[model samples]
Target: MDITNFVVSARNQALLYGDYNTYHKQLAKKLHNCRKRLNIVTRNRGKFSKKEPISAEKLSENHEYLHLQLLTAERAWAHAMRFKAVHSADTKGITGRTRSHIISRLDKGARAAETLVNVLSDASTSGASDTDILEARAYASMLRGATQFEKQSWEPCLRSYATARIIYTALSTSMRGDIFKDLLSETIDPSIRYAAYQSKVPRTLAIPTIARKAFPSSDSALVEQINKLAPDLLKKSDSDAQKGQVGAPNAPQTITWRSREVKIEDAAIALALASTDTATALLEEKLASSDVTLPREMAAAYDEVLIASQDAADATKHAIDELKEEGVSQNDPRIQSLQITRTAVNYQMISWRIGRNRVLSGEHDGALLDSAPTTTRKSKKDATSRKPKIEPTGRKISRLKDKVVLYDSTLQSIDSIKELPGVAADEGLLEQLEATAKYFRALKSLSIARSHSLTDQSPNAYVLTKHAFDECQQSAALFSKHGASSSDSSPRNIEIRQADIQFLHNLLKGELQRTRAIVQIDSQRQKAAETVPPHGGSPLVQRLFEYPEGGANLNHLVDFPPKMDVIPVKPLFFDVAWNYIDYPGKEPVAATTPEPEQKTKQQAQSQKKGWFGFGR
Candidate 1:
C-alpha cells in the first residue's frame, strides 16, 4: 500500500484508541527507518537510469509516492494536537478519565504519521536529489519527536508545516498527484492563525511570549484577544487576595474573572486620618519646644514655627471638612483633631494679632508726642493742672511717684533770680540789645538755658567793658527809683537781668510751639503750600520794617557810611601863644628893645587879622 493509504488507515486506528503513547513509540521507530532510506536515495539520485528504465510514467509514480508521504506527514499533525490537549489536561490535574481519553487519541495520530514518513523516505532515497531527501527526513524527524507536542512546543510544528506548505504550493500540477494536489489546494488548515491568536493568553500569569513575537504582524483577532485578556489579568492581580502580597506574577491565571470596584469614600477617610496624624505631631513638637526657655533669636524662630504649624493645622481642618462632605464620619479622630487644631490656630492668631496692634499703637503714640500740639504745656496753669496724677494702684504707680519726687528735687536746685549777681553798668543799650538777641538765638538753639553765661557763646564775654560799665549805671539808676516800690528786698539789678532772660525764654518757647503746630497741621493735611495773593503786603516787604541799624530805607541800612567824619580834630597851639605870638615872624626888625607900643600895635594887628582874616 502507498504511504498516503497507510497514513489514512493508521490515523483512523489512532482515533479509535484515543491515546497517543503506543502510537508515538511506533511512529518514532517508523520515522527513524524512513530517514535512513531517504539518505540512501539522495546519495544514489545522480546514478538513476534515464535512457532505458527511468521513463515519464515512473517519474509520475515517484511524484505520487512523495505526495502521499506529505499527506501522511500532514495527518501526523493530528497526533501533535491530541498530545497538546492531553499534556495540558494532565498538567492542570484534570481527572484521570478525561486525561486517558486525550492520550488515546494522541497515540493513534502519532503512529499514523510515523508509518507514512517511513514509506515516503524509502521511496525518495532510491533516486531523489539531496533536497528531496532532506525534506523527507525533516518531515519524519518532526513526527517522531512526540515530546515537542507533549511539552506544548509549537515552534517546531509551525516551522515544519510552513516548509511543507511552501513546497507543496511550488510543485506543478503534473508533478504532484491529483489527490495530494486537491488536499493542498482545497483544504485550509487554520492552525497557524489559531495558534497565533491563542498565544495572546489573556488570563495567563506569564506575559504572552507568542503575542509579543507576532505584534504588528499579528492578526487583528489576536490583538483583540490580548486587549480582552489584559484587563482581566490586571483586575485579578489587584484583588483583595493579593493584598500585602509580593513577587506575584503580573498576569492573571484566568481571563474570565472580573475586578471589584474601589471605594472612594474609604480612600478619602484614610487620607484624612493620615493628615490629622501629621498635624498632631507638628503641634506636639511645637508645645515641647515651647516648654523650654528661649533666647531672643530662638524665640523669633519659635514664633515662625508657631505660624507655620497653625497654617498646616488650618489646611488640615479644611481637608477634614471636605472629607466630611464626602460622607466620612465626623467623629473620627482625624475629624475631631481638625476642630481642635483649628481652635488652637485661631487662639494663636488672635493673640498675635492683638499684640501686634498694641505695639504699633504705642509707636504711633510716641510719634504723636513729637508732632502734635496736644502734648505741649500751653500755659503755666495748664502745665500745673495737666500734671499726671499720682494714684498709687500698684508697684508701677509707686515707682512713677518716686520718679516725680526726684524730678521735684531737681527743680528746687534752680536758684531764685534775686540770689544771682547783677551785671556791670558800662553795658550800652546796643550791647544789651545784641546780648538779648544772642540770648534768643542761643535759647532757640539750645532749647534749655538758665542764664547767659551758661550758653557756649555767652554774650557777656563779647560785650565791651565800657558797655558793661554803662549798663551798670543804667541798672543802678533804675534800682534806686524802683527799689522803694519793689516788694522783694533782693537786688533790683538782678531782677532786670532776670526779666531779659525770661523774655528770651518766652520767645523761644513761642517759636517752638509754632514749629510743633506746623508739623501737626502738616501731618494731618499733607498739602503743599498754596501760592496765595498777598492780602495787604507780602511777607518779604513786611520783614523789611524790622530792619536793624535804624536806616530810613532797606537799601540805606544795608549800606551805611564809615565813622571817620565824626572824629574831633586836635588844637595846634595854646591860648597864650595865640595872643602873644601875633605876627611873631613879622615883628619890627629889632631896634633894641623895640617899643612896647609897637609890639602891642603888631599884636592888635595880628589879633585883628586872626579875627577878620586880613594881615596888618
Candidate 2:
C-alpha cells in the first residue's frame, strides 16, 4: 500500500469505467465544488504561500483528485473519437451516416476538453505544488468547460472552474496530503503563487469537511500522507506564510498563466509585460531609428502639380471681376467723349493755322477782294480833360477875407500886447496881458466859423474881445492906483503898457508852442518808453523840473499849477516872487529913507495951510 502507487491505481480505475460524457459531467460538477472550496480557502488564508508545505500539500491534493478525474475523461474521450471516426467512414445508409456524423461531432467536441485536461494533468504530475496543481486544474477545467459552454451553455463551466479553484486554495492551507505540495509546485501559475504568498488567514479551527465522503477511497490515503508530512510541512508553511505576509496581509489571490501567443502584435501589451528599464530603452531605440525629416515642400509641389490650370479665358474673367470691383469700364461713353474733346482741343490751334495758310495761298474764292477797306477812327478824349473851370464865388471870397481879418485882428492884439514896455517887470501886468491875449485867441478861433460863410459875424468873437477889454480895464485901474500910491522911485510903480502887451503876446504864443511841443514830445517819449519796464521812473519826470509849490516848470517859461487846491496862494506867489527876485543877471534897486525933522515940518505946514485957508 505505497501512497504513490495507490494514487496511480485509483486514478486508473476512475478512468477505466469513466463514461467520458457522464464522467466529465460528474467530474465537472465535483471540480466546480472543489474550485469553490479552494477559492474560499485562498481568500480566507490569503497570506499563505504556495511554497509553504501545508498550503502546497492541501492545494495539490485537491488538484490531484481533479486531475485524476480529468485524465479519465481524456482517455475515454480519445477512444470515443477513434471509434466515431472509423464508424463514420464505414457507414453507408443515411441513418447510419447521420448517427456516425453526430458521434464524430460529439467526439471532436469531447477531444478538445480532453486535450486541455491532459496538458493540465501533465503539469500537475510534474513538480507542481499545491497552488500549481490547483491553478493547472482550474485552467484545464476552464478550457474544457468553456468548450462545453460554447456548445451548450455557460452555467456548467462557470460552476466547475469556480469550485475547483476554491477547493484547491482551502486544501493548500489545511495540511491535507503529501502529494498536494508536489502537485502545487509542478502546476501552480507564478502569478497565483505570488498571490498565495501574500495572502492572510485567521488562526481558527478548520472548516467541517462536508464533501469528505465523496472521496472515500482517497480519504484514508490522504490522512496518512498528511500525518507523515504535516510536521515538516507545518513548520515550512508557517515560516513561508509569515514571510509572504510582510507587506500584504490581506492581498487578493490572482491567476497567472503562460499565454499561447509567443509574439504580441500590440506594442502596448508587450511593453506592459516588459521591465521598466527595458521598455524605456526600447522606446528610445525606436525613436533613434525613426526618420524625422518632413517632405513638406515636395508635398506642396505635388499638390500644386495635381491642381488644374486656369485657361486664358478664366484669367480674363478674373481680371474683369477685379476691374468691376474697382469701378472701371472697358467701354465708357464719358471716357470716349473726354478723349475726343481732348484730341480736338489739342489740334484746334494747328487747324486754325492751316486754315490761315490756305486763305493766304488764295486757294478759296474772291470774297477777300470784295471786302471793304477798314477805317481807323480817332479815340475820344477823357471826361476829366473836358471838365469846366470853376470861378471863385463872391460869398466864398468874402468869407476868406473875413477869415483873414479875424486872424489878423487876433494876431495883432496878441502882438500889440506883447510889445508893451514894462510888462515883463510888472507883477500884475502879465496877468492882465494874458487875459487880453487869451480873449483875442478865442476871437481868432471863432473867426474860422465866420469865414466859412455860415455866419456874417461871430458873437463869440465880440464877446471874447469885450471880456478881454473889461479885464484889461480892471487891471489898468489896479495898476494906476498902485502907481499913484507908490513913490516914483519904485520900478513896480512904472507903467509900461507896450511892454505889458508884448509880454502877454509872447506868453500866449509860448503857450500855444508849448502845447504843440508837449504833444510831439509825448509821442516821442511814448515810443521811447515802450521798451522800458512799466514800473520804472517815467521819462516825462526827467524832462521837467519840480517847482517849490509842487508844480512842474517847463524851461522856466510854463508853470503847471499845483494839483491840490488846499495849498495857499500866498506860498505859491512867494515861490514865484522869490524865483523872479533871485533870477540871474537882474539888478536889485536900493531903498531911500525919509528925514524925521523934514517929515515933521512938512506935516505941520500941511496942517497950517488947511486952517489958514478956512480963516481967509
Candidate 3:
C-alpha cells in the first residue's frame, strides 16, 4: 500500500465516524420529536398539524426520514378532515368509546415506532433494518386511522388499522395475537355493532348473560351483545350457579345491615302472603258449604285459619315498624300502603265471620231469590234441574252496587303503594329493593283486581288477571337479574314472592269461572222467585198493579250467592256485588263437602298439567 493512500484512508474513516455521531444525536432528538407529535395529535392538543418544524436538517437520512414520516401522518390527518364520513358524532357526540380506542391505538403505535427507531438509530448500529423501518411506518399509518376514527370516518379508520395489523404480523419475532390485539380491535366500530344489535337480538354476546335479563327494551340487545364480547370488559360470569357471595362482585361497597334487612322483609312478605292464602282457603271452604247448617268442625277449621291470618298480619306490622326505625318515614308510601291493606283485611274478615254466623243460625235465609211461599220452597237438587229463572231486582242490584264500593277501597289502598321508597344501602341492594317494591305493588294490584272482578256486574276477571301476569312476569325477570347473588340459582330471587303471584294468577282465572257460576245461580233463583207473589198484598191492589196477592216475608226475599257446588271458592268474601251496602254470604261454618267435581289422582294430575303446562 502507498503511504499517502494509507493516511487518506485513515482520515476518511475519521470523517465517517464524526458525521455518524452527529447523525446519531439528531436521530434521537427527532425520534423523540416523533413521539411528542404522537402525544399532541392523539390527545387532540391542536386543531392543525405542523405546530413546529423538525430540527437538524443536515442529519443523516435515518434521522431526517422518520421526521418526514411523522409529518406525513400529521398532514394525512389534517386532509382527512375534509370528508364528512367521520363527522356523524359532531351532533351526537365524539361517536363513542370506539373513537377513544382509536386514539389510544394510534398513540401506542406511535410509541412502538419510536421504540423501533431508537433501537435502529443507536450510534453502534450498522444501518436501519427493513423490518424496523416498516414497523415505524405502520405506526404512522395508525395515526391516520385514529384521526379518521375521531372524524367518524369508519371506513378509512378500518383500512388503516388493517394495514397496521398486517405490518405487525409480518414481524416474525414480534409478540403474539394478544399483544397486538388493540390494533385489530381498532378496525371495528362499536356504534355500528350497536346499530346492528337493534335489528337482531344476539344469542351469544361476550357480556354476562345474566345482565341481558335486566335489559329487554329495544336498546338493550346491542348492549348485551357488546358486554358478552367486550374484550376489555368484565369476564364472562360463572356458567353455572356458584356459592353465593356476601356482596355483588361488581359492586364497590360491601353489603350492610340495611340491605340484609330489606332482603329479609321482602322474603317475609312473600311468606305472609302464603299464610294468608291458606287461611283464606279454610275460611271460605267452611263458610261456603254451611249455607244453611252451622257445623262445629267447619267453624273450628275457620277459627284456625283466622288465627293464622292474624299472625301473618302481625308479622307484616313488625316488618313495617323495623323499617321505620331505619330512618324510613312513617308517612312513607311503602309502609303506609301496606298498612292500609292490613287494615282492610282485618275489618272485612271480621265482618265476614259475624255475617256467616248469622246465616248458619238461620237468622237469614240461604234462598237468594225473590221470596216464595214456605210451602213452595224447593230442594237445591230440584232447583238445579229448573231453567234459568232469577232476574236482577232493585234489591239485588243495590247489593251488587255496594260490593263495587268495597273493591274500590281495596284498589285505593294499592294505588297508595305506588312509587314507594326502597331500602337504604350503599351497595347495589337498593336496586334489589326497588324491584321488590314493584313486585309487591303488583301483588296489591292483583288482590284488589280480584275483588273488583267479583263485585263488577260486567265480566272483567280475565282482563284483570292478564294485568297481574304482566306485572309479575316483568318483576320476575328483574328479580332474577339485578343485585347479584352468590350463586346462579340462589334463593336471593325471593322465590316465594313469585310463588304467591303465580298462585294468585291461577286464582284469578278460577275466580272468573266462579263469578260465572254465581251469575248462573242468580239467574235460576230469579226465575224461581217470579213464580211466587208479593206478601200481604190487597187483592184489589194486586189485580190493579199486576202483583200477586200473597207470598213469603219480604225479609226472606233473597240470600247471598249460593256455595260453589264443587269446593267452595277459597276465602269467600262477604260483600254483595251491589252499591252503597254490602251483604256478606252470611253463612255459618259448614262440614267439608266432597267436591262435586272431584277427580281421581290421575285426573287431577292431568288437570294440573293442563292448567300449568306453560310453566313446563
What digit string (tens of lDDT, one per residue) describes model 3 on residues 487-595? 4222111222444434544554565566567657767777766765444432333254444445534543333343344555755443333333434873332357546
**RMSD value for candidate 2:** 58.3
Ranking by TM-score: 3, 1, 2
- Candidate 2, residue 487: the lDDT equals 35
Q: Candidate 2 — which residues are off by over 4 angstroms?
A: 1-71, 80-147, 158-281, 285-616
Q: Model 2: per-residue lDDT, tens digit, 1-616?
A: 1223333344445657863354445544555565465553345546965622223334245654444344444444444444444454563523445444544544454454444334433444433543433434443443444344323433443343333333443455664545444433343322222222222211110111111211122434333443443333322332243233221122111112112112222111112222222322332343244341122221122221111111212322332343354466747542332233222222222222222222221211111112221133223565356664453455554543444454354345445444433234555645544544443343344334233323433343344334434444454454454442333221111122444533434443443454445456656777755544244333345444633343333333322452344644655566456634745685453255548986696566656664554321
Better model by lDDT, 1 or 3? 3
Candidate 3 local accuracy as lDDT? 0.42
* Top-scoring candidate (lDDT): 3
Candidate 3 stretches with Cα past 4 Å from truth are: 1-61, 75-134, 140-157, 166-616
TM-score of 3: 0.20
Q: What are the lDDT figures for the candidates, one per model?
A: 0.38, 0.36, 0.42
For model 3, give the RMSD to the true fold: 35.2
lDDT of 3 at 410: 33
Per-model tally of clashing residue pairs: 27, 57, 31
Please identify which of the two predictions, 1 or 2, would achieve the higher TM-score against the true structure.
1
What global local distance difference test value does model 1 have? 0.38
